[model samples]
Every structure is written in structure tokens, then in C-alpha cells.
Target: MQTIETVVNVTSERQITVQLPPDIPTGEYDIVIVINESVKSEKLAGEKKIKTLKFSAYPVGLVADNFTFRREDLYDR
Candidate 1:
């Protein structure tokens, strides 16, 4: 078994072409492909601008005015 690592560009038709080394004789063999997600995300980052979300506090009156948060309240008594 041997491993060859190389980067290839994907065509508009969603196809990839890889050239094997001449030393590797022509024969039927099991092939495995792995796509790196980080590389894909990096490429997409340049093509689209993601909107940044602004954090804001929720409006009042959702909970009782007298309600208070306590660590003990989370436990099953």
C-alpha cells in the first residue's frame, strides 16, 4: 500500500482530476478520498460576507419583576 498527497482544483462541473506518478504502475486499486472542511470553509469565506450579530439584552416584563436568580434554585430539592 502507498499514499500520495496532492491538491487539485475542482472544475465547474464538480469534477476532480488527479495525475498519479509514473512510478505507480497502471493497475486496479482501492482509492480513498478525504476532503478537508477547513480548506473548503476558507474558500467560501472569500466568496461570501457573513453578517455579524449584535448581542442585546431581552426586553423587560418577560419574567416577574421580583424574580431573582440563585444557584440553589437549579437543583432538585
Candidate 2:
């Protein structure tokens, strides 16, 4: 996969202008956009902040310690 790094300006219309490298051949490619939090702009002031959670692994140690209950314990009143 070819990685191209460039800065894009977000217009007043809430659209980003991305310019692909000229050396890149014409073909469909997956695009991933990441915004830097350090770069503040007035355009983002009105926009609502979005909270995102990153992928996490299950706590195997915690589950193992908590899974000591017997099968009958689950069905008991």
C-alpha cells in the first residue's frame, strides 16, 4: 500500500480538499483521515465533539477469577 502525506484545508461548507499525488496511478484506494487535536481552528468551534472508543482486549485475568461460580449457582433462586 502506498502512503501519501499531505495537509488539507476544510472549507466553510464542511468539506476537505485532498489532493492525491501525481505519481499515484489511477485506481480505487481506501482512504483514512485522521485529524490532529493540536491544530485548532475557528471552523471546528461550532462542531460538536465526538467521543470515540478504541478497540480493547477482554480481561482474561478478571474473567478467570470471576468465573468460579458453578453451573447450578446460575439457576438457583
Candidate 3:
């Protein structure tokens, strides 16, 4: 697995997004994503979990306001 750090510009229509690998296997997994912390800043403004995809190691389309992340096709669509 790869650990990636990226910057997302937040504005009137943008929020931070953190995505997983494209292919996920079946099992149990945990995910954590945070945003808006510069090295000089002292507070942790954002720390969140992608909490819509059923929490299975394999799921699909974790989403929130202006943000989304996915790694698998959890449904038959």
C-alpha cells in the first residue's frame, strides 16, 4: 500500500478528498484522513474517517460534502 499526502484547495465549492487504492481485497480495514495543517500551524483542523462505505475492507464510494473516496465496487450496480 502507498501512503499519500496531498493538498486540496478549499473554497466555495471545494473540499479535501482522500482516496484509497483502486483495488481492495476482502477483509477488515481502517481509514483516516485529515486536512488543513501547515507545518507552522498549531491546530489540527480536520481529522476524519470515510464513514459511509460499510466499514468493510472492500466497499465503494465514501462521500461527504464536496468530497469522495473509493477503492472497490461493493455493490452490484
List the candidate 2 regions with Cα displacement exceeding 4 Å: 41-77
Best by lDDT: 1
Encode model 3's per-residue lDDT on 1-77: one tens digit a residue.
54666655566766655454567666786756665456325333344333455555765654656553444444455
Model 1 lDDT per residue over 1-77, tens place: 88998887999998999999899999899999998888888888888887789999876663776666776765767
Worst 10 residues of 3 by lDDT: 39-48
Number of backbone-clashing residue pairs for each candidate, in the order shown: 0, 0, 0
Clashing pairs in 3: none
- The 0-to-1 C-alpha lDDT of every candidate, in the order given, reads 0.85, 0.71, 0.54
Q: What is the C-alpha RMSD of each candidate to the true structure, in Å?
A: 4.0, 12.2, 24.5
Worst 10 residues of 1 by lDDT: 59-68
- Estimate candidate 3's RMSD in Å: 24.5
**Model 1, residue 69: C-alpha shift (Å):** 21
Tens digits of per-residue lDDT for model 2 on 20-59? 7798889787888888665554445547565668998876
Comparison by TM-score, 1 against 3, better one: 1
